[model samples]
Target: MYERKPVQSWLTDMDGVLVHEGQPVPGAPEFINKLRSSGKPFLILTNNSIYTPRDLQARLTRMGFEVPEHALWTAALATAQFLADQRPGGTAYVIGEAGLTTALHAVGYVLTDFAPDYVVLGETRTYSFEAITKAVRLINDGARFICTNPDVTGPSVEGALPAAGSVAAMISKATGVEPYFVGKPNPMMMRSALNTINAHSESTAMIGDRMDTDVLCGLEAGLETILVLTGISTRTEAERYPYRPSRIVGSVADLMDEI
Candidate 1:
């Protein structure tokens, strides 16, 4: 068993560890409040590329969470930041939603339909054949490919929906080029979050539910990881996996108790 240590900062996964289907896990708010009261800094790190920081803050607040806009970090934001640093003012072919487009534009990327320098792939609920074809043509012409994350699907009340990874994989199959993933299980997103908070890896703990993405990502980044059971992962499933978190708790409530 891994012993718990004193952590000064936290990097939390939003969808599973904090809430589920727009509902806060039991005692989640109080748990977060306790962290704040204890003077520990935390940021909600998520691979979901659908929403901007302000949008996520509103959604979480409506769900009874006291999340501030600055406390949230999404893959979309990390991708935009990366693009901004690598190819500022470059034209991009976006196969994503308004949130992604907004982030890119905010970071000085130009949106264009012709001869784009980059092809950014993300989830689109209303993805059309025309859009896919256009993106493929751009990639075929040698545009750099970038994907928000590699998650095949996202959990929802109705079931799973095709995520950015699935769409990016389809495009890669058509163009014979793999995309550079910018989300969890990749170290870039974690680095971006740490830089955002000016926090060091040793002092930060990543609280999440999924072992493959969340816990593994944290461990790979050398951050302490805490696994919660309120989302896609169960204790039984975790036992069967090779990657183990630094700690396991029943829920966010249990996490608060341990911390």
Candidate 2:
């Protein structure tokens, strides 16, 4: 029988596992403190591409979570990294906020709509019809389609708003071209994250609140997956899936000792 190596690094989802509705989850702060004190390599992962790591770091600081910008990873960064690897110094027609645009710029991607290399879609507060129309026409013209993530709806103070996936669907319907998503549940995201931290899969653990994205991505990335109940998934709901997490805990607080 083979044995897994002891966990030396950690990757955790930011929304449900750490915060919900703009409030920090119980024991989340302590867990973060523990990781900091232990000097263990850790990252807070999120499929949200609206905000850059610096922006997210500030948001977390406001919420009393002292997370550094280097400890944060967003789908925007992952998508930009993937694109940089696939096509160095490429041009893209981008539809997103500062996060996605800034990331692409950092990776030497030129954002334009005129016969670009790719039509990249990401999360935005305002999804304009004109922009979507441009994206659709561009894809029909020959540009490849790429999406930051496949989340259909995102939470807001009002309610769930149509997200990147929803807009990607409309574009796909028009052009009959489906985009390649580079965020959660895609093992590529996990691999990129692991590479970012220089952590090995066998010695890293993933903590997530969702089975569809976080747990699934971690499992596929060969990291031990820990499902927590503070988010969208419940213990019962998790069992409905074919795969199971390595462990299930009430919250991040439960694993404080592990760090």
Residue 161 accuracy (lDDT) in model 1: 91
Q: Which residues of candidate 1, in runs, are more than 4 Å off?
A: 1-5, 257-259
lDDT of 1: 0.87
Candidate 1 on 1-259: residue-level lDDT in tens? 7554568788999888888887998899888788777776789988887888898888888887887688899999999999988988888999888779999999988999788999998767777889989999999998999998999998878999988888888898999999999999898899899999888888789989899899999998889988999898899999898878987988878867645
Best by lDDT, which number? 2
**TM-scores for every predicted model:** 0.95, 0.98
Error of 1 at 122 (Å): 1.3
- The digit string of per-residue lDDT tens for model 2 on 1-259 reads 6588999999999999999889999899889988988998999999999999999999999988988899999999999999999999999999999999999999999999899999999999988999999999999999999999999998887889999999999999999999999999999999999999999999999999999999999999999999999989999999999999999999999998788
Q: RMSD of each candidate?
A: 1.8, 0.8
